[model samples]
Target: MGIRLMALALIPMLPHLPFGQSSLSTSPLGIGTVKWGRTEGLKHAPFSLPDDATLHQLLDAAEAAGINVLDSAPAYGLAESRLGSLLASRPNRFHVFTKAGESFSHGASFWDFSESAIRRSVENSLRLLRTDRLDAVTLHCPRHDLSVLSQSDAPAVLSSLKSEGKILLSGFSVMSLDAGLLAVPHFDYLMVAWNPGFLEHQPVIEAAALARKGILLKKVLSSGSFTSVSPAESLRAARNLPGNPVILAGTINPHHLRDNIAALT
Candidate 1:
């Protein structure tokens, strides 16, 4: 058979093998809290607060189902606060990853990628999460000015935080390969969206693997286009990748979270 046809035939069996599974082998699948405590009145959704009771239930469900990594951001309004309150008394095994760059305003959000902004955002995340430090803090997308992150200065800042024991890992989220490759050497992890509809990122995934950087797969559900592939299929595809370890799917529903966990199992 031709090489192209041979590779195509292997696609169906990719998920059955163990490839990207090791990255997450030590960590449970992640849950993104973007919608938690989010309101719709802002540019995207403003003045929104997720119901505390509902959020608590969701956290409980996630924990019960063995999800240990929870990702949030300051731009996510009250999400960090809610997560902090919910998991405060729980065990410390849960990994919380947050982002810097954007802040919430009156019915809108704005980006602030200045050094001051990065410092303040990390401080705020520590305060809101009720923790002394964070497990991971990503760049949370490219800056509004589109200025590339300075490798020398950026690493210094994140290294300073590491020295202070405030953050365990520093990474960035990028929509394009150029940004991803730019941040790779400076950061420890890279969160990128990878789904069938957005296969443009396949090369990025391969590059990250070659770089030995940890890869966090986001938007695996393609923003509710679950009909294209099941969660198991998504997990399988991620596992087949060279270095992808964790895949995060956002959902406020406990049942959906459980279903996602089932796919990994």
Candidate 2:
């Protein structure tokens, strides 16, 4: 039972909606803010971090081009805060997806999954992003910790947050097929690194479709691993997946961003 097949099975029960009707599906493009406001001293610089002014211009350009989703995380130093300030007045213009589970400390990263940690992360993200609620908050790639999404208490906490309208959905960032499979049944979204270099987990795409989970394709450029393939080729390969609609390719260059957006159109 592939994901597309599963969606077909449920189609009759679902309302007759237009294809690409959802805001997410309508645009196969999203902006990743990992380099938005962070200093290069913290992490290895894959590319130069864009300045605040440059980032603001990029956001404005993305919005003008009709890109709606902006992916950020609190772990990215001042990324959430910079994004919050940029989008404070135009929050409704774009869908904001952020993450918990990871935080920055002394030029390094750490992960925590205690219930208190999860709650605090969400609260801090809300404050830093200057938004009352997030479109989605994924558990930033935790190791050996499924309790956040599997334990009996986990559902209560997430459900409470959802019920209170603090978050539209919850999910986990997966690095392996097995992890993705485990998360499929429990999450509403799945953020996975998918690119030419790592195609073995393509099955997870089908799994996401089966679960009706939104698939956020990250590392589509493979972190500069496959520089030979043009951005258009990368975008085409990602879009060719039956159920993938949103792809996030991180780049600090506005010209590159425009080039990537051109591929989607």
Best by TM-score: 2
What lDDT is reached at residue 180 by model 2? 78
TM-score of each: 0.81, 0.84
The positional error of residue 208 in candidate 2, measured at the CA in angstroms, is 0.5
Clashing pairs in 2: 3-210
Give the CA lDDT, 0 to 100, for residue 120 in model 1. 88
- What tens-digit string does per-residue lDDT give for candidate 1 at 1-265? 9773453343211121212322333343678777786665422323245577767666666655556778899988788888788887785857888988777777677776666778888998999899898888887764322253643244467768878999988877876767776766767777878876677767767777788777778887776656667766876676566674577777777667766766666
lDDT of each: 0.69, 0.72
- What's model 1's TM-score? 0.81
